[model samples]
Target: MTSARDIVPISARLLERLEALGTPRDRVLAHAGLAATTALSTEQFFAFWRAVEEVSPRRDLGLVVGAEASERGYSVASAAALHAADLAGALHTLARYKRLTCPEVVELEVARGEAHVRFHWVLATSEVPRLLVDSTFASFTSLARRGTAGAVAPLRIELARAAGDAALLRERLGCPVAFGAPVDRITFAERALAARFVTADAEAFSRVVPGLEAELVGRSRTRSLRDEVRLVIARKMSSGARPSVDQVARGMHVSARTLQRRLGEERTSYQEQLDAVRRTSARRLLANTDLDPIDIAFLLGFEEPNSFVRAFRGWERTTPTRWRARVARG
Candidate 1:
C-alpha cells in the first residue's frame, strides 16, 4: 500500500469544503490521524476516505472549496483578479496559485500553443478517481466562466483510463472524452487565449501571487523530496545507468544519509526505487523497442548480459528472450 505521506498537501480547498460541511474540525482531524502517527498508510487513508465520502456533503469538495475561497477572497479566482490583464493572465494566475491548494499531483503549465494542465492524484481511500476528474473539469469550468469569453468549452479531455461515472463526465464536461490515452490533459484552444475577462485588478492580483506562492513553496518542500528521488532514478535509468543512493543523493544536493533517512520516512528505500524504475523501463523497452537482450542490458546499466537476464527473470519470472518472443508471437 502507498502511504498518506504519498499524498500530502491535499487540496486545501477540498479540506475547507469538507470542514464547512458541518463536520467538526476535530472529526476531520481524527479522520486524518495518520498525519500524526506516521504518513497514513495507503489502506488506512483509503478506508478513512471512504468513510468521509459516505458523509461528505459535496462529492466535488475541491470545487466547492474553490468556490468558497473565491467568495472569501483567498482563492485562485482572487489571484486572477489581481493581474489577469486577460485570459492568459488568469491561466498564469492559476498556475501560480494551484500548488497552495494541492501539492505534487496537479500541475499547470503554459506554452506558446496552449495551457497544459495535469492531475496525477493518488485517490484517498474514500475518494473516487472520477470525483477528481469531475472536480477538475468543474474547477476549470469555473475559471473559464470567469474568463474573457465567459466559460468557453474545453477543446478535448484525454483520460489516461476510463472512469466509473462516464455519464456524469459527459454531462458535466460536455466535451469529447478520449479514454485509454497515454496521458490525461485538457486542451484549450488558442482562441480561448485571446478572450477578455471582466475583472482586471492587477494590483490586487500582484499582491496575492507572492503570498500564495510562498505558502505553496512551503507546503511543497516536504513532498518534493520524494518526487525528486523518483525523478532522479527515472532519469538515471533512462540514460542507461543504475544509479546508487550516493549518486542520487549527490545529484539532489543531499548527503547519502539524509536521502536514506527521508526515504525511510516514506517507507521506501533507494534500491527499491531504483528497481521499480528499472522494471518499468524494462517493460516499456521490451514492448516498444527492437533492441536485443544484451543491448537492452547495457542500456539499463547492467554490466553483464547474464545479470540483465537474471534481473529480467526476477521481474517477469521469465527470460527476457522468451518475453520478447511471447510478445512477438502475440
Candidate 2:
C-alpha cells in the first residue's frame, strides 16, 4: 500500500473550503503533520475531515463544502481541464492529471448513451467514510457545472452507502440519487460528452499538456529499476497476493530472463527487492500504525506470523516487539 507520506496532497480547493468554514489552516496542517506550504497526505486530509465533523454542527456540511469547490481549486489538474476543448476532453484531462492532487482512482466509461464516471478510494478499507463519498461527488458535480456553465447535469448518481435525506440529496446534487449501489458513480447523457466547455482554451491546453506530460515522464525516469520492482511488489502485497518473478516480469512487459539480466546490471535480484520492500514496509507499519505484528505480516503477504518474526529477526537482529520498543524510545 502507498504510505500516507507518499500519497499526493488533497486538492487546494478542498483545503480552501475547509478553512473558509472556520477550520484553522494551521490546525489542520499541524494535525496532518504537514507544513503550511507543502501538499498534504490523504491520511492528513481524513484527519482534517474528522475535525471538521466534530466542530461543525452543519447537517449539510458536505453539500456546503462541495457546492463551493470547483475545478479552479484543483491546481494543475484544474488547469488541464479548463484548457480542454469540450466536456469529455476536460474529464479525460481530469482522469489523467488528478493523481497530481490525490491518489483516488477516476475512470471514465462511455456506453449505452451515457458516460459512467466512477470514483474509488485507493487506500479505503471495507467501511468507506460518508464524508469522503459525499465530498468527492459533490466536488465533481460542481466542477462539471462550472466548466459548462450549468449546461450539463448527471442523469443519475450511484452511491455505495445508504442514501441520506432524499430531498436534501437532490437539492445538493441536482440529480436523482440512488443508494446501495455497487460503485460510486455519476452517469451523464451522451450528448453532454460533446458539449463545448465554457472555459476551453485550445491554445493554452496545447501549450500546457505537453509540459505536464514531460514533467510526469521526467519524474518517472528518476525512479530506478529497483524502485519500480519495489513498487510492483508493494502493490501485489496490498492485494493479498505475493507476486512471483515471472508475474512481475510479465506485468512489466519483459521476459523473466531479461528482467533478471536488468536487475543483475544493478547488482540486485528479485528476492533482494522483495526483502528490502518488506523490511522497509514492516518498519514503517510498526512505527506509525497500531496494527499487530500478525496483521502487518498478513499485509506484507507473509502466510504466517512465525515466518514474519523469523525474517524480522534476520533483518533487524531483534523481535518485532523489541524493535518497536526501540523505535518508541527514539
Residue range 77-178, candidate 1, lDDT tens digits: 344543587666666666655544433244455567766565543222222334344555666655666554455677777765434445555556666766
Error of 2 at 180 (Å): 1.5
Clashing pairs in model 1, backbone N/Cα/C closer than 3 A: 46-125, 49-126, 50-126, 82-202, 82-205, 148-196
Query: Judged by lDDT, which candidate is best?
Result: 2
Q: List the residue pairs that clash in candidate 2.
A: none
- The residue ranges of model 2 lying beyond 4 angstroms of the native Cα positions read 1-5, 10-16, 26-39, 125-128, 221-330
Please give each candidate's TM-score. 0.55, 0.62
Task: List model 2 lDDT by residue over 129-239, tens digit each.
Answer: 466667767877877787788998989998755456678878889999987553467999988989888888888888888888886665554446875676566557644
Which 10 successive residues of model 1 have the least lDDT summed? 121-130
Q: Against the hidden true structure, what lDDT does model 2 obtain? A: 0.72
Which candidate wins on TM-score?
2
Candidate 1, TM-score vs. the true structure? 0.55
